[model samples]
Target: MESGKRKIRHEFLALRNRMSVDLVAVCSAGIFAGIKKLSAYEKAKTVMFYLSCGSEVVTDFMINSAFGSGKTVIVPAIKNSGDEKMYAAKISRLEDAYLFVYGIRQPEINSGNIVEKNNIDLVFVPGLAFDIKGYRTGYGKGYYDRWLKGVPFEKTVGLAYDFQLTNQLPIEKYDLPVGIIVTEKRVVQIKGDRGADRWETL
Candidate 1:
């Protein structure tokens, strides 16, 4: 499963790297629009969003919109500490959220503002690819996987492009499937196993 995941991850990374700036913006806008239409996001007071980097779907618009719309925005941040665990840090300003870049001076994030896991109402997850059933594989860090364990599935959503959706994906013991996945093509809502009535495609 690990080898399969690695291969799929590489393929998706290469695919994303080849995308034009216009394509990324267009698809990301569509997905972001779909998110805003969801009742889950509408009801969420505090939302956790992954700071996008590299060729992954850009989240700047979504994050900035959240900041201005009276919603508490939380981004994943790691303090300069021995522990490598990803914590939910509330960021009021876009500059406070750091990016994975070289030669760029990073802003110091105060660990004192770490929010509890239960405080986040909605989470926007980033992934390289996602299966039709909503299982996703990321950059192999497992940061979101570990942090999102035990989180209600309905509250978590995966952001991806239309081409990133595959028929199947490798899964591991700790891999938790996403409850909803939004792409430029459509929105997929997965409640449980395939037999569940909650399984839906929007």
Candidate 2:
């Protein structure tokens, strides 16, 4: 399963990397529009957003828009400790971020404003690929999975481009699925209960 997931991850990464800058920009705009239309996003007072890096769906627009709308924005910061645990740090501006793992921008950990898991109202997850069912293949780090274990599935969302959506993906017992997937083309709501959902895309 790990090998299959790795292959799928690489394939999706290559496809995303091949996208033109203009196309990425256009798709990102459409995705943000769809997110803004969601009642969950509208009602959330505090949101967690992953900073985009490489071929991932761009999230600067969403982050900035959240700030402009007076929403509390929290970005993840990786700990250098052996556990490499992920923490939610409050970021007031983009300048609060610095290059972290794999040159991905992350908020400063020492900011002294870590947000509690229960305080988070919404979470926008980043990944290499996602199926309509909400199972996602990340960079193999499992940071998002571990961090999301405590959050309610209904508040978790995966942001992706249309091309990244596949029909199915390899799943593991520890792999956490997102409750909803927002793509440039459409928003898919996974059906059934939270953790035990059948992994069916609605």
Model 2 TM-score is 0.93
Which residue pairs overlap in candidate 1's backbone?
A: none
lDDT of each: 0.81, 0.86
Give candidate 2 regions above 4 Å deviation: 81-83, 194-202
Residue 30 local lDDT, model 2: 94
Q: Candidate 1, residues 50-88: lDDT per residue as tens digits?
A: 877766788878989997889998887665544457778
The CA lDDT at 174 in model 1 is: 84
Give the per-residue lDDT digits (tens) of candidate 2, residues 16-126.
999999999999999998899889999999999998887778888889999999999998888763555888999999988888766779876775788888999999999
Which candidate has the top score in lDDT? Answer: 2
- The backbone clash count of each candidate, in order, is 0, 0
What range of 10 consecutive residues in model 1 has the weakest lDDT sum? 99-108
Residue 181 shift from truth in candidate 1, angstroms: 0.2
